[model samples]
Target: MLIPPRVPNRREDGLLHFDLLPPLSLYVHIPWCVKKCPYCDFYSHAISSAVPEERYLTALEQDLEASLPLIKGRQVSTVFIGGGTPSLLSGDAINKLLVILRNKLLLTPDVEITLEANPGTFDDDKIKAYREAGVNRLSIGIQSFNQKHLDILGRIHDVNQAKRAVEIAMTHFDNVNLDLMYALPHQTKDDLDADLTMAISYDPAHLSLYQLTIEQNTYFAFNPPDLPDEDTVADMQDMIEMMTATAGYEHYEVSAYAKPGRACRHNINYWLFGDYLGIGSGAHSKITVDGKVIRQTRFEQPPTYMLEAGKGRAVDEEFTLSHEDLGFEFMLNALRLTKGFYPEMFEERTALPLDSIRPYLKQAEKRGLLYRDPTIIRPTEKGMLFLNDLQQIFLPDE
Candidate 1:
């Protein structure tokens, strides 16, 4: 029932033009967390003083209002409010924010609205308030249930707090996603098994299982923890696939799993190379318009973003994607799916013929990393295991 915006012409001035615009999603970022995790690197600042909720919300509204003209007439299919812990805001704040979005944007009747919550930051009433605010879905950041692992990861919530958060989320929302990470420092197979068992016990609609990795500029990178070796991590992944399959979860994406018909639709739009407008401090956006694909970003700092937004221009950077950029970027996202994508989808999203990636396809196939017939293109098992290498094959230089 999703209706896409249509373009009258196919091409303009030798530039790419979409006959039908890809499905669009909306992302709102809240840039404050009670405390930053040691291994985290997302654009989030720890709260030293009381959050300027009213000022920040005003900035978000202004930011969205100014960007509406670019996405005029397009129906938004999904909305995901992510963060530095968006749950830090009060339920009334969330209500006001969604009301503004609803008033300004053309959201579908059944738009899947999601807000990310962290343990220790929300109670049952807050969770209930979020649900009442038209947020139909909740994604909780319950990184681990093990006390030792939780401490090692420097998470703000304790084991009991994690369980309480999930219990509360399940009480209010039917569609919920739990974010868990495995392959932690000094974590054992039994430890992971216990965590997975605890997560499945709730029968949540979806689960996002991730392998912990130390990223540059994070505390963990400077003082690296004693993580399990590569082979052990591989075994842990295999164990996750088997366990989740037994629990009726589908391994849809590399780091995402879900029950039947419960996949994260907003994220799926991303994997399909669809367009999304991201608003807030340090948020990024991919938009298709004027016969071209453009990328945009807002200022990273909260104060700077609010000041810029008040001036009716919150975006700090913008650039159009080249043909090479299109081909590589499309595959970069599409190939993450287990079922991969169809040639028709590639053409629709990238506005480029499948012929553009023929050489890269052949190269990947030659290395036994890809599978393609006339109708579909997918990554083989080996390809999924070595996903980074497979995605790198389609790089512009390659």
Candidate 2:
């Protein structure tokens, strides 16, 4: 094993104090995939040949080394390896990367490590090795089991492949999440219901149900597909919530459903406005040091990031969040939760007083978009439906 880099303690005793520091999570992005999906806008590149495994691993380590000083004392509560297709990396590579991360970061025992995999990617041995590599969760991307829908979505795997992936995952791991998209182009209510039924049949621990939307610069944006009308899409969302709840899964986040004690901790952290260190190409990090939050972004291109990592300067852009920026950011994340957030959490996470958004909160409540008690503040059913309008109230004042 390689020796980890030393973390510098740059804080003075008086300046280092924080009333409360939010939980830290690590997000490692894998930018390469067999092919890029059209509706997807996240930074991803298509690759057909061999993956540069060793080089990327080394770069990731150096990326962390450069980050150590910023997050000196906090412990990482969870890790999520997301991407173009993290499963594309070999099992041995995953083991090696986890080993190095464990050596460097103060990860808790029983830490939740998750990896995102596409259908048709892994088999029995690979899943087993991932479990051994300290990855406790697997999120299988099964957009839809309907063959026509799958092909329309440009998924490489067939319906059988998606089913087989889940079956193999169940045998090796207990915690699994299925990523399913609804309101796909030309999809009907029955089409969506069937997809949800198939997902529920597997009894995955968690499900991320998102509506497919055309993103700017993607193929779908230019050549928009004929999609379900607004009314039909709304019906689909309603059906999803009722069905998942009936099956005993909690509709936690706006688009997340999970069984008891099976919610995705990493994503929950994000929704709670918690801190995280992001690594790899186009990975973004939000860390609070000495009560001031700073953001950093690695080089956007894979080749550029790899080269920059060698010099311990993978971060191409970095900035401290303004007070107004912090307030808006906190609301942006916290309002995503169905159950909402505690009133005082705003201060703890963003170091901004709750009064910053008090006017907006009042206005939203008056409009029936939110419900506030003495302690907790949550979105109303209307707020969940018109989430964009509710969140817009919290934007930084001009």
Off by over 4 Å in 1: 1-12
RMSD (CA, Å), candidate 1 to true, equals: 4.4
lDDT per residue, candidate 2, 208-236, as tens digits? 99999889999999999999999999999
Error of 1 at 248 (Å): 0.3
In Å, residue 15's CA in model 2 sits off its true spot by 9.3
The lDDT per prediction is 0.92, 0.88
TM-scores for the candidates: 0.96, 0.95
RMSD of each: 4.4, 6.6
lDDT by residue for model 1 (1-398), tens? 11222323346575776778999999999999988898999999999788898999999999999999889999999999999989999999999999999999999999999999999797999999999999999999998999999999888899999999999999999999999999999999889999999999999999999899889999999999999988889889989999999999999999999999999999999999999999999999999998889999999999999999999989999999887778889999999999898889988998887777788898899999999998889999999999999999888763
**Total backbone collisions for each predicted model:** 0, 0
- Indicate which candidate wins on lDDT: 1
